[model samples]
Target: MAIDELLDEHEQSERVREWLRRNGSALILGIALGLAAIGGWQWWQRHQANQQSQAAGDYQAAVDAIQANDKSAAGKVQALPEGIFRTLAQLELAKSQVKASQNEAAIGTLRAIRTSDQALTAIVNERLARVLIDAKQADAALKLVATGDSLATLEVRGDAQLALGQREQARDSYNKALLKAEVGTPQRRLLELKLTEAGGTPPKTESQS
Candidate 1:
């Protein structure tokens, strides 16, 4: 009986060894594939980090150029990747252009900042409208600021409407601007003056909660 049991154990061991010999290569291949997948993911993460770092450096350089009042500030900004930083750089460049009496160039620069962000779009539109108004393109300015809700945007719209001799629309826009502006602030005072110009009275200030 002892000899029979030893033979049985030996048979079972041989069967296990045979199974491993048949399947070992497949198991090794699966482990290799998993390791390759992990390596690929790590490489992608590193690549993305490097790209972001480079973009940040380029954006900072453009900002520094603008601050230094470099004549090439716009060129530096134009070379940046399309993003918020690029949009801000363009705005700074447009301001510089306006200061240099380059109204047409400033209008073109401001119009180029077409970001998908709502806040950024609003800011760009407000700036573009102001430039248009300055250029005596009141119709274009009115179209740009027509849907805006902010105090500054409303003021620009009012300015445009007034320029077009649309006194009633200008009065409504100035009133809206006054409502959005902070009480006792210079902006509110200006809005009040505009409202008066449009033949409307300023509303009494309410406490902001």
Candidate 2:
């Protein structure tokens, strides 16, 4: 190699080293940040998984306690974190309270539950309206159920209307509920009875037909 070519190569190598020296700290910092971000994401995923697992276990325990009619079930349900499981637990607790003739408590229990799911909210509203009716808050119950056309909602609305002495409206609501409630089911039979009590005729049964 010529002397000039060797000197040019050496200069190129020195330039490359100088560039590295100038930017090495920035490159190292970027790599460190990237690794930290990955580790943080992994930690978050694990934390979420652990939370879900714990929630599942707590929910199952609450269910078992409720089914056994344990008096402490309400506390367990109340202690549940806000989520689907907690909403479901609150529902079970409300039902138990209702069965124990604690209508006021059931109303409170049902009211405390909140969810973003429209369908689940409708179910909760139906249950809450029923308790409202039992508590003689028929006006509130009617208002709560007035917007829903579901069979359960209609039936509860009918009950509320009946409580408010709106027999004709009750009859209409019961008929609406009966239209959606399948024949031969207990729900259909109950709605049919309610329709009759509201001075409306129910559809003929198979035996009657």
Candidate 3:
């Protein structure tokens, strides 16, 4: 019992002396690192919250402007003229633009989104291709398809192939889409329609060359 007590006292004394030896520097560095980590986390959390809040507020304001039947006001207040907002809003607004016989303006909106948002660029390009095909701008449409941003969803790829006069390829895309979709699903029905329109049966899908 005495030996153990003495050993414990010696350990406590060594720890005290060691702390005294390194005193200020060790404490400062430990405090500094803890503060740096805490500060960094707080900064990141605040920044993320701000960006999300901004995106949400901007979206709500634009929705309100649209509900008031003011296209010009909505456009003016929207966050982007050529980026994320421009992509979704204009895409949503394109039908209205077309109904107003503003085909050129609708096309312009989609084209602008294609340049600014790489994440959505592929879908925009795919839609742009369809619009161009409808307008008989075949070469331009093909170019957009070639520079796709995302994995070409089967629907988009099928439409692109049909536009390019590649009926076989269109059938293939439709077939893949049908397989990916569940039986009796709406997506499967859509793919079937596309295949029928292409005038070809589904081909056996091997590795994409």
Highest TM-score model number: 2
**Candidate 3: pairs in clash:** none
- What range of 10 consecutive residues in model 3 has the weakest lDDT sum? 200-209
lDDT of 2 at 15: 97
Off by over 4 Å in 3: 1-18, 66-69, 73-86, 114-119, 146-209
Candidate 2 lDDT over 123-147, as tens digits, reads: 9999999999888899999888998
Cα deviation of 147 in candidate 3 (Å)? 7.6
How many clashes does each candidate structure show, in the order listed?
A: 0, 0, 0
- The positional error of residue 173 in candidate 1, measured at the CA in angstroms, is 1.0
- Which tens-of-lDDT digit does each residue in 12-129 have in candidate 3? 9999988878786888888999999999999999998887677766766665565566756436434544446555665666545556666676677666554445656666777667
lDDT of 1 by residue, 142-209 (tens): 99888968888889999999999999999999987877787888988888888888888887766533
lDDT of 1: 0.88
Q: List the residue pairs that clash in candidate 1.
A: none
Considering lDDT, where higher is better, how would the candidates rank from best to worst?
Answer: 2, 1, 3
Candidate 1 matches the true fold with a TM-score of 0.84
Which should have the higher TM-score, number 2 or number 3?
2
TM-score of each: 0.84, 0.85, 0.59
